[model samples]
Target: MAVLTGVSHAAEPLALCFAPPHAVAPDVRSQWQQELRLILHHSGYELKLAACTPESIELRVLRSNPRQPQALGAARTSQSRIEPVVEIYLDPLAELIGTRLAGPLGRAMARVTAHELRHVVGQQAHHQGGDFPEGYSAGLLLAAKPAHFRIR
Candidate 1:
């Protein structure tokens, strides 16, 4: 599931939209949004909530497994000639949460979102490693606590 953000110029504000899975609690979604904002802020970016379309980050939810792939979330960089569309899968996160209803899935998911955004916003065509500007290993990003990556 790719959310399309048309060619966003530097002059336009960075905006985003939560696709579906409307069933998710507002507070949970808000919490996730706040987490993402904090992460992006530390990375030197501002986030704005936008409509479902017309140039914005589309947050979409997908089945846990899209053919038993290893990645928990993926971003579409080639979808548009310009800005890429970001998508995060919920199934793997659900698996990690495993029967624990109180697990930090929301927080984890937010981290995944931030990881993808780094690729799109940072204009980084390739990942450095398991960290961000430092490098990014999806596995490490998903498994570690948010505190692990401190703000500079």
Candidate 2:
């Protein structure tokens, strides 16, 4: 759960939060949380984990005319709204739970979550292209290997 600010020069404030894992299998939940935390730590943002009312997250993206390449192009813009509560569902019951694939998948979700938070904070316009830094990718997160026990 990380929240970034100033994604783009003209984007609205954004917030990225992580919903508690609701995996039926304890091990799976633990793994998922761990991977999420790793990516969040590297995202260079703040984390806020609290209870909310609504059960779903709200994300909005608006496309504007492209700006000049060289000159400080116009700032990008964005808007986001997160419900009070987080929606939770059973984790996928796949045999790859504790394998290399599981780690990468969890890392990918974490990256996406962090990427979204950057939008909320106003770092980038939306979750596309190389707008974000290089390390946001799952391969990088895995290669770096975060030290924390669980994804916060």
The lDDT leader among the candidates is 1
Q: Model 2: per-residue lDDT, tens digit, 14-111?
A: 23333343322444334555654555554443343334324323321112123422211122242444222222211221211223355454543344
For model 1 the TM-score comes to 0.68
Local accuracy of candidate 1 as per-residue lDDT tens digits, 1-152: 99878855353356888777644556656767777776766555677877777677787767554665556666676644325567777666656555213235566667878877766666566665445543345456546766444322
Q: To one decimal, what is the Cα RMSD in angstroms of model 1 from the true structure?
A: 9.1
Q: TM-score for all predictions?
A: 0.68, 0.37
Candidate 1 positional error at 57, Å: 1.5
> How much lDDT does each candidate structure score?
0.62, 0.36
Cα-lDDT of candidate 1: 0.62
lDDT of 2: 0.36
Poorly placed runs, candidate 1 (over 4 Å): 1-13, 21-23, 79-83, 97-103, 133-152
